[model samples]
Target: MTGMEPLAPLATAGRRIETAIIGGGQAGLAEAYWLRRAGRECVVFEARKRVGDQWRERYDSLRLFTPAWADGLPGMTFPAPRSSWPTAREVADYLEGYADMIGGSLWAGVRVDSVEMLGDGSFVISTTSGQWHAQNVVVATGSDAAPKIPEVASQLDPGIRQLHSSQYRNPAQLLPGPVLVVGASQSGADLALEAAQAGHETWLSGRHPGELPVNERIAGPFFWFAQNYVLTLKTPIGQKLRPVIRHGGSPLIRTKRADLDRAGVHRTPARTTASIDGRPTLDDGTVLDVANVLWCTGYLPSYAFIHPAVIGPDGYPTETQGVAADVPGLFYLGLVFQRGFYSHLLGGVGRDAKFIAQLISERALSRNTVAA
Candidate 1:
């Protein structure tokens, strides 16, 4: 009731719709856009008060590696220095703009507490607002809702101001002392660099994937390496030939080695355990003094709220690249392998969304024909 101006939540209830897309990030928003184009009744459920909470919660200095030109929706073009990277704020703004262009039907601030399958083969989404019934549900929240912090981190001394990379913004906000940045992913590297450059004694832990020069780090080489070079590419012969490399242990993006080397960040071995002695204890028993600790470990995909049947044993949705198996009307988008080759990236959302929308359209049409 009273679904008025922006930043307002609609009082949705027991009513049913053709599609209910969860998480208003790129994937959720993209699917909603395409569904609207398909003339399907749909609504977007965003857990955050506003859209793009993920981006907003990220480090203030965070910028997309991909250019703004590659970051636009299907039709809309992001106005900017095409080749230059856009800040996290720009990304949030662009998503908001995309929503506006798609016409604001999204219900922001509505958090889906749980999605349960009803006896009649529909999804009952228990949200912060109320219940929503939908024939199809898309889990587009992506990963990173669950940040994997060390279990030992909680036992550290209270004097240590600790924060995850997700919470880190700028160095000015951190305690004015030495900072220990853990996990040298893109986020970790960027944060470490920012901290070190800010005149703080920063120690970057774990083996960092040193970034190549911008000229050498093009997307073509990256993909080729990931497919042909890395071990993730499972093939008839490649799987057998590939080494057992820990892909999960590294970041998708490279951390510029030149920047880190220039920053003089003390590189420590990969941590086994973290304990607060005089300083912080590593698995190797070496101690490092740190006034602040920034853990950039990684994120976990939390599908705990998803209905059990929809989720497989892996804690991820059981589907062939985002199509739910146990549940007919259930779908997943914006995931790692939802569709196309690049489903998780902003550049891939438009392509994946169109594919999912077409499938939904075809199914609905087929049902209508059968009924007729």
Candidate 2:
């Protein structure tokens, strides 16, 4: 479909398409842009009511860790000062604008239920609205979809207000009293600081992932260059650091330990491992009596919609770079450390998208030639 064409109606049966990109976020949109440039027809399926709802749904005070200059996707620059950090709303607005500029077929408010590969290698994508039959399917749904909360959360007092970081909007949602923010990554630190600044006694649980070696503003260009070009799977250090980054989580980008301390946020080195008498218990045997608990524990990869044949034990697709080797035309995008540390970031996803798009275009051409 052309950029000028209206969004195709949802067919309850199955609408055939050349390529179905299973997301409308930065990753999916980038793939669509590259495919369009390659003269390939494609459609983007976005579960949200609108493009960029993912970012908009984050905490109200959320802003990109990277400066605006490093947050734009392919074909468009983020409309903000280069050195400025764009807020969540601004990123969302930019995505919406980028989608409009791309003008590819995008189905909003459509949730894909499942993706099954046929005997012939084509895909059957079942969705809330309808089904789509496509020769190629790019799973660009991103890494952070499902919020990860520990099973011990159920033991917390029912009176205690609990919320995962994803569900938290602002301090207003928190109950009046001391708040315990679990997990000391960027989100945890940010929320803990916010809670403390909001006049609540806040305790930040779990050891931090560490902070940047230098202030990002002072080393913006160098940091960008390292993350984008130097720190890659191709390098020995990048390979060694991959597991630490993937499992331990990225280092604090915006939130620093000093910042948390400055906000009067109590920092705990122990993790919130259990609950005692309806209260949070730390691994160090300290029990925290708080009115609210904010779980900033991060997210798990959710690819349950994908078929078992395509998904691995890690809940991720078995793919190299972005191309699925087992399933010829199946691809994945925006995976953490997919190609490098920046693979899932806005500025970095375009490279993986471009690579996958080229492969898909080449395969399409080969298929057409064979048929002819």
Number of the top lDDT candidate: 2
Per-residue alpha-carbon lDDT of candidate 1 for residues 306-349, written as tens digits (9 for 90 to 100): 77555655455677756788778888887654433356777667
Scored by TM-score, the top model is 2
**Stretches of candidate 1 exceeding 4 Å from the true structure:** 1-12, 213-254, 276-278, 309-314, 337-341
Q: Give the Å shift of residue 192 in candidate 2.
A: 0.9
Count the clashes in each prediction: 0, 0
lDDT of 2 at 5: 48
Q: After superposing candidate 2, which stretches have Cα over 4 Å from the reference?
A: 1-13
Whole-model lDDT, candidate 2? 0.86
Q: What local distance difference test score does each model get? A: 0.73, 0.86
